[model samples]
Target: MDKIKVLSIFGTRPEAIKMAPVVRAMQQDDRFLPITVVTGQHREMLDQVLKIFKIVPEYDLNVMGKGQTLSTITNKVIIGLDTILENEQPNLVLVHGDTTTTFAAALSAFYHQIAIGHVEAGLRTWNKYSPFPEEMNRQMVDDLTDFYFAPTSQSAENLRKENHASEKITVTGNTAIDALKMTVQDDYQNPELNEIFDKGNKVVLVTMHRRENQGEPMQRVFRAVRKVIDQHEGVEVVFPVHLNPKIQEMAQKELGNDSRIHLIKPLDVIDFHNAIARSYFVMTDSGGVQEEAPALNKPVLVLRDTTERPEGITAGTLKLVGTEPQDVTNAMIELLENQSIYKKMASAKNPYGDGDASLKILDEIAKSIKR
Candidate 1:
């Protein structure tokens, strides 16, 4: 049997973290030839994850630029993959999650009449602009998708509601859990991390960089965080600031100058996972961390008002506090002061996956190609 050629496409740090396991699985499987393409949507951060996963993309789009917009990213990814898709003509093009790269790559595959398999598919906020381009990106990608790899039964049901064929959908769990297995180590160490761990302070690992949460919302959250940290002697925060200039400026202006609040550069997958492992809990406006943090038994206080990952909320692993200062501050205080609440949130079973998502994805891909 001729090995099926599968081209896996992704760009952002979150996408890279989740897709790494599936891509690695395909590389080892003799039944498929995996071709990796990175849109370089996040540049340095994307490269950091790629390096940690030891993935070398055959094509690097290098799509990032000064003050790039959503329209620009979509245009760049579509244009870049046009020739690649025409030349390689793989049996399937696999796109992960709901990034601009995911949508654009799937569009390119559809234009070429090639089959597209969407990993982490069928997630819907239903509100088109709630997550900005992401909610629409996943919906549009699923519309063009020939195969849907939903992380849970809820996501698969979302696909069904949209009239996607059940036969094409596979509930393989989230690959983020699979990534946790590879990243979190018992002896992980970093200079800053080591110092924090040595201090014996309760670490609050924070990652907040979303278009909606920028400006006043972010500033309010930062102020709340600072207040919480100042009030608690044993609590410390390690915030990996996003690379966006606006975000950096805002984070530095509001959250810097405090010894208890450590503002560091964005972390690679390994460091970020280890940080989650070592942290007492997590606070973030990011998507993947909502899924990943729970696997490490860390309670998450979602900084956003609305989340697509409600499974975590239902399972008691996450709390939606939004960006209001009082709400944010009170949630932080509750988790810090209330041991019973913290224990309940921390011990809840991760609703995402069981760490075999990559293998299941591979098996489904192989079966699809055979058919």
Candidate 2:
């Protein structure tokens, strides 16, 4: 059999993290030849994850430019991929999650009459603009996709609800959990981590760079965390701050100057996973962390009112604390004070996966192309 060629495309940190497992899986499988392409939509951050995964893209779109708008990114990816598709002409084009890169790449593949595979497909808040363009991006990408790699059964059902072909949908768990297999190590060391370990403090890993929680909501959550840390003597927070000027400014102003709260620069996949591995708990407004943390046996306190991964909540691995200061404070306090409650959350079975997602994805890809 000829090796099936698959061009896997992604642009952001989250997409890179989730796609790393599938890329690595394909590299080891003799049945497929994977061509990696990065749109450079998130340039530096995307490259950082690529380095961690040791994935050198067969092609880089380099579509990123200063002061680029969503429309600009969408248009550039379509145009850039025009040349890429003409060259690589893979059996399948695989795109991950909802990004301008995901939607545009799928659109371009459709234009060229090539089949597309959507990794992390069928996640929906259904409120079109709730997640900005992401909701629409995934919806449009799915419309063009020939394969659906949903991370969970619920997500597969979501695709079915939208009338996506059930035969095409594969519940492969989340590839992010699979990535931790390569990233988290016992010897992983960082200055902040050493300090936290030296102090023997209960560490709470914090990440709050969501579009919804930008200004006031972010400040509120930061203030709540600050208050909780103030009240708890043995607790410390390590926040890998996002590079967005608005988020940076707010995080520094609200959470800075606190000795217990270490505000560091954004970390790559390896560093972030290592930190999560060592943390006692996690507090975040991001979607990926909600799925990733539980596999490490860390309880995640979601900063949003709702989550697309309700399976985590139902399985007792995640708690949606929202951004309200009082609610956030209460949730934090309950975990800090109640050992049984903390144990219950920390010991819950990870509903996301058992870290075999990459193998499943590769097998499905092989079967799809073989047929």
Candidate 3:
């Protein structure tokens, strides 16, 4: 039989990290011709993950522009893939998560009459605008999807609730867990984090940069964390600040010049994973980190009011504290003062995956094509 041709596309750092394992699995298998394409939606951040995972795409859209909008990204990805889809004509086009790139690529593949597979499918908050475009992006992509690689049973149920064909959905766990098996190392070291961890300081690993949480929300969150750092003697924060100019300004104004708060450049995937592994707990508005932290036996405090990854909350691995200053302050203090609560959250079972998601995704894909 001829090899199955699979075209995989992604554009942001989180999408690149989660999709890398599946792409690499397809590359190693003899039954598939795997092609990679990156839209450069988040150029520098995306490049860092690609280099870490050693994935060199066949096409680089290089579509990032100054202050790019959702429409611009959508337009660029669709137009960029038109000639490539016409040229290669892969049997399946695979996209990950809810980025504008994922939605646009799936739409383009639909336009070309090609089968589309969506990885990390069927996640929902039901509040479309809470996560801004992401909630709606994934919902729309599921409509265009021919195969749904739902990361958990909860997500699979979500797809079914929307009347997506159950036969087309597979609960493959999360590919982010698969990436952690490759990146997080026992011997990983960072000088600053090393000393902090060595001294037995309670480290709060933080990453919060969503469009809805910018400006006042971001400012208040920072202030709350800073106040917590002051209240506790050995508690310190390791915040890898996002490079957005407004965020940079807010982080500086609210979180800077603090002895206990370490505001640094964004970390690469490997460093980020290891940091999570070593930290006491995490506080973030990012989705991927919710899964990644629980895998490392670290508890998470989600900064958003709504989360599509509700499995974490149900499993006792996450707390949704939102952006209220008092709520944020109380959550931090509880984690600091309540050892039983911290231990319980830390020891809860990770509901995401067991780190073989890449292989499971590939097996389902092959079976679907053969049928």
Using all chains and alpha carbons, the TM-scores for the candidates as numbered come to: 0.98, 0.97, 0.99
Rank list by TM-score: 3, 1, 2
lDDT of 1 at 259: 88
Candidate 3 structure quality by residue, lDDT tens digits, 1-371: 88999999999999999999999999999989999999999999999999999999999999999989999999999999999999999989999999999999999999999999999999999998979899999999999999999999999999999999999999999999999999999888889668767877888999999999998999899999999998899888999999999999999899999988888899999999999998999999999999999999999999999999999999999999999999999999999999999999999999999999999989998999852
Clashing pairs in model 2, backbone N/Cα/C closer than 3 A: none
- Predictions in order: lDDT: 0.92, 0.89, 0.95
Clashes of each: 0, 0, 0
- For model 1, the stretches where C-alpha displacement exceeds 4 angstroms are none
Write the candidate numbers in order of decreasing lDDT. 3, 1, 2
Number of backbone clashes in candidate 3: 0
Runs off by more than 4 Å, candidate 3: none
lDDT (tens digit, per residue) of candidate 1 on 104-193: 999999999999999999888898987878999999999999999999999999999999999999999999999999998987879978
Predicted candidate 2 versus true structure: per-residue lDDT over 1-371, tens digit per residue: 79999999998889999998899889998998889999999999999989878899988999888888989999999998998899988999999988888999999999999999898899887878756678889889988889999999999999999899999999998888898888898887788568775688899999998787888999999999999999999999999999888899998899999999999999888888888888889999788899889999999999987677788999999999989999999999998889999999999999888789889888898888852
